[model samples]
Target: MYQIIVGIDEDEAHAKLCAEEVVGMPGDGSEKHVTLIHSFTDNPSGASATQLAPVREASDVLDEAGIDYDVTESSGDPAEAIIDAADDVDADLIVIGGRKRSPAGKALFGSVTQTVILNAGRPVMVTGVPEDA
Candidate 1:
């Protein structure tokens, strides 16, 4: 069975899209296990409702697909948390979402997607937010 880790945050639409892509992959749900990860920089309990939205959205998508999965909440840098989770689970693949960003914006605020893509030992699948999304 392939173990997959999906990184999610406040962008619910992008997160759900990532989950959907994984579900659409060639394989029965039983043969692919999914882990949805949400990383928080501070106390998870202090997170506002908005911060948890993506996790909920992604969970709903996986649930509707009848995909076996679990949710993980970690406190630290988002990219590091996601990579650590993958290592803990021995994930075969990582699915993450990205959004269009200006070069200046990317340079100023390093991208978690980019970090994971570079550091993840396993294959990484990246999904992008639709232009209108």
Candidate 2:
């Protein structure tokens, strides 16, 4: 079974993009699974994973593509939560949204994406590419 840990933030567009990538994954078997992780730095309302808009949107994309996923809500550092989920699932790949680069080629990544890219033991795929690229 192929396992993927998708790090989804508050942005629905990013989450959709991440899920679109899932649809393009190499495998077609029902064995392919995705672990959706949404990290909340602070929660005043005490929302669950299923309550988040981004997670729900991502789930919609996954559902349309017939991909299976499990939601995991975490509190604390997003990178840490994603990494831990990856470790827990022994994920084959990690997916996260990334920042687009400036025309001068200066690209800034979100801290969570940067951290995951630098520290994850497994492969990390950052979604969103510069238009020119």
- Report each candidate's C-alpha RMSD, comma-separated, in the order given: 2.3, 3.3
lDDT of each: 0.87, 0.87
Write the residue-wise lDDT of candidate 1 on 30-123 in tens digits: 8889988888776736874335878888888888988899888777799998999999999999999998999889889999998999998889
Scored against the true structure, residue 125 in model 1 reaches a CA lDDT of: 93
TM-score of 1: 0.90
Candidate 2 residue-wise lDDT, 67-100, digit = tens? 8899998899999999999999899999998865
After superposition, the stretches of candidate 1 with alpha carbons farther than 4 Å from their true spots are 43-51
What shift in Å separates residue 12 of candidate 1 from its native position after superposition?
0.8
TM-scores for every candidate against the unseen true structure: 0.90, 0.87
Candidate number of the best TM-score = 1
